[model samples]
Target: MGTMGMQGPQPLPGISHVIAVGSGKGGVGKTTVAVNLAVALGKLGYRVGLIDADIYGPNVPTMLGVTRQPNITDNSMMEPILSHGVKFISVGLISPGDKPMVMRGPMLHQIIRQFLQQVLWGELDFLIVDLPPGTGDVVISLVQTVPLTGAVVVSTGSSVALQDARKALEMFHQVKVEVIGLVENMSQMVLPDGTVLDVFGAGGTERTAAQFGLEFLGSVDLNPSVREGGDRGMPAALAGPESNLGKPFFEIAHRVVSRAIEISRSESDVLEIS
Candidate 1:
């Protein structure tokens, strides 16, 4: 089997910018960040597509409340399920419940390629790929297949999380993919009695971003409503911009867009020169 390393990067049709939301390890709320960013971008009037590329643990379908099977077109392309003004596809939608996927690297490559090529994602301004945590086969396959505009690394405020987050950042750099910025999730929390708590510690993620000269996108507080919204099949970002729970996501989305545009322009310049 030919790896993405063997072939030139292939751009997805009808998608302008491809953003991968990933983490160095699991349980960092990477999927949640990916979902919220997509939703927030949609709310800002950008036509967006979201791919739940976390094949092993595809919870995006459940998180977005899209349990229905996608429609197949006459051309045999799978239509993306639309929700909250964004189009999305997840392996969870077609898979038979939480049964584990036991595929090797080759199988993983084919699936990722099919998701990009066979899905009829029609004229998307942005395609947000929710990748599995870690620098694994899937991540390598994706970066090789698509000329990603950039990547967003997500991490919690803990030291362990930062260590993994650093690994993720280094992986992106090694692959020549632009690290758009870092998003620190579950950074802070407030008690019912107005007492604030730094449950996992604070500012480490931002400091790391600064150390690496990357933009510190921002942090999202550890809000109960974030989890509650996910359980309700409604990400906090879709709760509208005025919502306290949703505001941080919107802020992050704005930074992501700005960075993506900057990267695109830089690429265009180099192409023109070459």
Candidate 2:
């Protein structure tokens, strides 16, 4: 398997960036950031794949409005569902629509392993992984087993989420996983006259990122369209990139691409010296 003994993570092939979009807590728009970011990357002409790794609360199947199950090939590889010009595979798509997953750790590991080894993911420029909230065993297993390029931490600009976000970052550090940076979701509200409101008590995420010497990718405005789209099983970023809320996701995508290039270059320079 490609994941086995993944050789030093040296600028891996078949995919340029494998980013885990995660948060310290749920309800902080973690998956929303992930799906929209994948769409935004696709819009920028990079072939992308979205993995709904949130095994427990899988939602990509619904967020992208994908209801059909993927078919497995004779070789045992399953085709990923396609939506909004991006490829996807999710636990949400694995189970029947009305059922919830009750798998244990071994089963979770097996399913995750299958997601990697049994899915014929095409050569993608980016594979954005939407992880479940918090620093749990699943997250640790993924970091230990997968060749992640880096991770993006998502959180609201609130104290409670920030506390958890800090813990999440610490957990990533404990596992020697490099954190790409922080993204403040639902940071503010934009009004009709182009004014911004610090409704969630602004700047908490920014301050945390600054203290950690991490880049603050940027903040996403809380838009009614985003909520409405989620309710209607549509990702808001696809509907209108020009919209106030949708625009941030695109911008964040660009920033992440730039950060990735910088990291790759630095790593390359280090290799050259040795």
Candidate 3:
């Protein structure tokens, strides 16, 4: 995808693809999807990194079970913490505990830029940014800071969630970022006795994706094990791709990699023509 901002987006050195995982509104399990996606990509043997850009509610460290602060290199760059085979950095690392980050727009922009440029991420096949929900300052700051390969929007199957999800898609479109696809999280719940229940109503997210002409990556069930795993700081994706809990994330990761490659190739073609 083409870069944003007047000065244009700067590419991160040694990073092949940078993907942002976002949603229009909160409470849709966006961070869960992002964390699992990064872990799944790593499980698939790709080097991965994750950035918890949700400044106000930096839940990635909790979900990843990381509480250690990053080490500062001799050159002053923060070294990302390694967890579950993926290197990552989050505001939670710097300021741990229940205290909130009370800051203004300029401070938020500076923090985002620092996370993008000041971290020694080394080489990564994919750097997944878990953005705060909504079409707000963090999203704008991200695009202005670095060139994104594409974005993956997460939403539940609820119609109300889809309304905000549409807004997120529109925001990405307006910013000239290629939306890689839409992933429907907590789409359904499998009850005992071989029955399926539509917890948030069925097929709404996929329908929304079709309406926007974007790929419907896949659906994830609302399993209690998934919740328990997240709470226990072990993502369900650690079960590996062949397991039931991890298969969906692996499937989504596969589609995401494919879409990113397509976007990169298309951008190359545009560059050639220009």
Clashing pairs in 2: none
Q: Sort by TM-score, best first: what order?
A: 3, 1, 2
Candidate 1, residue 74: the lDDT equals 92
TM-score of model 3 relative to the true fold?
A: 0.96
Question: Superposing every Cα of model 1 onto the true structure, what RMSD results?
Answer: 2.5
lDDT of 1 by residue, 5-112 (tens): 476777887889999998987988898889999999999999999988897679888778877889998988999999998899987776748688777889889878
Give the candidate order by descending lDDT: 3, 1, 2
Q: RMSD to the native, candidate 3? A: 2.5
TM-score of 1: 0.95
Best lDDT among the predictions, by candidate number? 3
Which pairs clash in the backbone of model 3?
none
lDDT string for model 2 (1-274, tens) is 4667664323335777778888998989998888888888888899999889896688888888887899999988899988887899998888857688888888787776677657888798888888889987666656655677678999999999999999999988887777888999888897889898887767889899999999999888788888778767778778556876578888898899998888778777988999
TM-score of each: 0.95, 0.91, 0.96
In model 2, what lDDT does residue 51 have? 81
- How many pairs collide in each candidate, listed in order? 0, 0, 0
Query: What residue runs in model 3 are displaced by over 4 Å at the alpha carbon?
Result: 1-6
| Residue 247, candidate 2: C-alpha displacement in angstroms | 0.8
CA lDDT of every candidate? 0.89, 0.83, 0.91
